[model samples]
Target: MLRTMPLTKNLTLEQINHLIDTGHAFISPFGLNRTAYIVINHKPFMVVVTDVSINAIQLSGSWYNWDELEKMGGVFESEFEALKAVAGGA
Candidate 1:
């Protein structure tokens, strides 16, 4: 249970640029367009970039951070996949 999940990390410059370069479009659970970023937190998470704010999901507690950039996202999932579509793009 991801009770009161924390917004402990913010996207770094490197991570942000990488996301802008490789962020893949995905349909949110709400069926809107969003971009997905693989965030390297204590564990790996799928961060969904929306027009208003970013949302994240920890899929099965797996950890996978990209490159020299050390960044983090959030937790849990009942929403749709944000990490799925971008697995190969980055």
Candidate 2:
């Protein structure tokens, strides 16, 4: 569980951003309104990005394999900026 996993505590903003930017799964279309996931962790944490203009971001969705994120670019700097701009808008 999250309480037992030390990695959860090690999770940093930079790391989270990196995971979003270059992660195996990039920002893809989610719904008719251009929704997509920007997170790379299997801990019920999913960063949702909608209305890129406002840069709305939110963490929702079920848990997935965090390791999967490493397989991709592993994250990017832009993702960090966007996430902060919207404060991961819910």
Candidate 3:
């Protein structure tokens, strides 16, 4: 499946991180599925459903898998919680 339409517009790394940190970023519904914008080492990345049935997520434009994402810094319920997790070294 060719996806011409971008899931999100071109946002700078700082903008993306700001959105995530400020709790503006969210898991947006996409064609009955969902997508999330994540930041790793100040780099913006997207995680989207590859298989709804299995509740799988694939890093957009990259081969990095879910495990890698978890290792980098898994998704949290809220940005605040994520910040706490990092602070506490969780």
Candidate 4:
């Protein structure tokens, strides 16, 4: 959608790399579903499949602001789904 300077610190570079290196080990519960961190066009996003909401899977991502990382983030559904759109044919 729109990219802006992030005003939140939901995730860090180390954490992001960790997520990439380790698949859902931190957030994985019961091994039913896992969370992932993906970067698109210089932005980072967290993807997870949850039944708590009607939409099921949700995404929280954005252009992180190193100075003040507590804002400017948005929600995304799935990385695969998002990438599909980015690939120019969703």
Local distance difference test, each candidate: 0.36, 0.38, 0.52, 0.41
- TM-scores across all candidates? 0.18, 0.21, 0.35, 0.23
CA displacement after TM-score superposition, residue 60 of candidate 4 (Å): 7.0
Residues 1-90 of candidate 1 have per-residue lDDT tens digits of: 645232225857776567557863233332223434443443344444333223432223333322222243322232233243224222
lDDT of 2 at 5: 21
In every candidate, how many clashes are there? 0, 7, 0, 8
Q: Which residue runs of candidate 3 sit more than 4 Å off their true CA positions?
A: 1-39, 42-55, 59-64
| Residue 40, model 1, lDDT | 47
What 10-residue stretch in candidate 2 is worst by lDDT? 50-59
* Residue 41 miss distance in model 3 (angstroms): 2.4
Give the residue spans of candidate 2 off by over 4 A: 1-59, 75-90
lDDT for 12 in candidate 2 is 88
Model 4's number of clashes is: 8
Cα deviation of 10 in candidate 4 (Å)? 43
The most accurate candidate by TM-score is 3
TM-score of 2: 0.21
Clashes of 3: 0
TM-score of candidate 3 on Cα atoms, chains taken together: 0.35
Could you give candidate 3's per-residue lDDT for residues 5-85 as a string of tens digits? 333668788888997799666563333335544557634344554432123344444444556656777654345545655
